[model samples]
Target: MSPQQKALILPEKQGNFKVGSRSIPSPGIGQLLVKVHSAALNPVDYKIQDDGIFVTHYPAVLGVDIAGIVEELGEGVENFRKGDKVLAHGNPSIIDQGAFQQYSLTVATSTAKIPSSQSFDSAATVPQGLDTAIAGLYGKHLGAGIAPPWAKTASDLEPKYPIVILGGSSSVGSYTIQLARLSGFYPIITTASPNNEDLVKDYGATHFFDRHLSGRQLMAAISEVTDSPIRIVYDAISLPETQSVGWGLLAQNGILVLTLPPSVKEDEGKGRKAVSTIGSPHVPYDEEIFRSSWAMIEKWLSEGTIQPNNYEILPNGLEGIIGGLERMRMEQVSGTKLVAHPQETK
Candidate 1:
């Protein structure tokens, strides 16, 4: 085995990264050492690379969504043994020092075994949006189907309530639409550019509003979709402008969920609940809940009930990280994932 392995290194601040070599990681307690097969990128990567956020150190490797073969399991880890294919949002705690290496370390708790029929690329796409969807839907009293814990099922609680998701064209937004539809929400409404209306609708968005349209027109469009008041809304894009528009569209007692913090929180003519989800890996119990949810999601993907959206593959292996971050910094990427393949896996 080689003593050193290749990794994508973000050596300093702002949009500069290069492929570098580092010692292969060994699994620690409750951690699994994975020979990275492929990794998927998120907008957060470039955000940290250029206009940094949650970065603890420099000269780091950046990637959160990972799919790999388990080379070795750390002490006390039992559910996954060597050679199991798995995917996870490995190490959300730090920026840049994640799965963009030949070998990566993952907590067993955050990792889920991949279904046999799933490809590495397919699995790699799960974590980034799945965590948001799973976390957002958990613990909510929805009229949708009652899924066995972690599962998104049609709830008998209330069939008539409506759920709104802003920015349905985004990766997280698309996932929320699919999961919400599965949960039996009567009307799933979302806002996106006109180009994405068909794509978003394919994901089960029963109604689509063009944010580019007039605010009054957008509101009237949403109001025209369903007579029942909007009860829950998850804003995958939480820009101030979107929130302002969202405020007007929300129904009384409707819960507003944001992917990022809303700039303002005034009650907009209706009693509403506002909250933000930073995609924190769930607490132990909640973790188990999502684990089960993803398990069901995995089944759905295989059974064709759910679909995998766009994936932008970067095939330069770990060496591609720098360029990928550069693209992100320039805001050249939209509605896609930037991913790299590990040259070789043991």
Candidate 2:
């Protein structure tokens, strides 16, 4: 029999989560077998369990943010070696790659070494959020088609262009704010509860507004921050209300990027556009940008160019994830990622 490991499994579509066992998978080419130390929860995790939107297989494991130590490396994987601490965005569609397990396989191209400045729990909060930000900002097909800051011609471009991010305190929103700063977008405007004002500012938001404001009210408020046109509005929350606000704030010929499907209709006469972005590196359209950004993860974290989201560690390890997901569904968690230790599961 192959080696077995503990996993949090969903037995059927929209099924309840339960602790179960699965065999540890071997590292295939260009992959690493990791002993998962921390797995961070996202809104999508509960959505999958509730709506069964992504996974097709039964007895599925679902989680995407992972930070762990590499137990073994597959052929053609040269950048990482055994025992290297790393963080990766897991693919919940694949059972072997799901993060809600004691051990999982990670794609080498999408994995990055975790810098000493970060702990496993903190690092686990980054992969999915950061990838979503990268895809929404830099992906031509999946996002606003903005030029990446790392590109050679990026320095020659104009700066001080204003951008707005709805839900600045969200994991995706927080990373989007940081990357927008690096891309030289000025007067970085964001919306969040007033309590998270300082937190979003630390992430590089130049202007913060109360998220409860209506679309017209938000537009009026943002006008005070910058007279420049708002060419890009990233609705990290992407709820119908937030999308309405983002669409209202976007200037003619501007783009509205959404993590969820757009609720606002685009008008060709106005030349306004709406794009939905999927953050997975495995997606062919987003693969290039994800690889480019993942390459810089270590340096960015080490230099503090990118800061991990605030995280709350869940108790009782993997079993604790159930309550955490429920809290997320109830809108109880705010401005923080929920992390679980799979190895601590009993």
TM-score of each model, paired residue for residue = 0.86, 0.98
Candidate 1 lDDT over residue span 1-346, tens digit each? 6878887777776657777788887777888888888888777777777676666677677778889888888899988889999887765334322888878888777787777778788788778786777677663432111343334344534455678888897888888888887777768888888888898999999888876866577777877877777667787888887777776677776667777766757554556767666554633335555556655655676776666667777856776666776787676766566777876422
Tell how far residue 86 is off in model 1, in angstroms.
1.4
Clashing residue pairs in all predictions, respectively, total: 9, 0
Q: Which regions of candidate 2 deviate over 4 angstroms?
A: 154-156
Mind giving the per-residue lDDT tens digits that candidate 2 earns over 191-222? 99999999999999999999999999988998
Quote the positional error of residue 233 for candidate 1 in Å: 1.8
Model 1 pairs in collision: 61-96, 143-158, 144-154, 144-155, 145-153, 145-154, 145-155, 146-154, 146-155
The per-residue C-alpha lDDT of model 2 at residue 137 equals: 94
Residues forming the 10-long window of minimal summed lDDT in candidate 2: 151-160
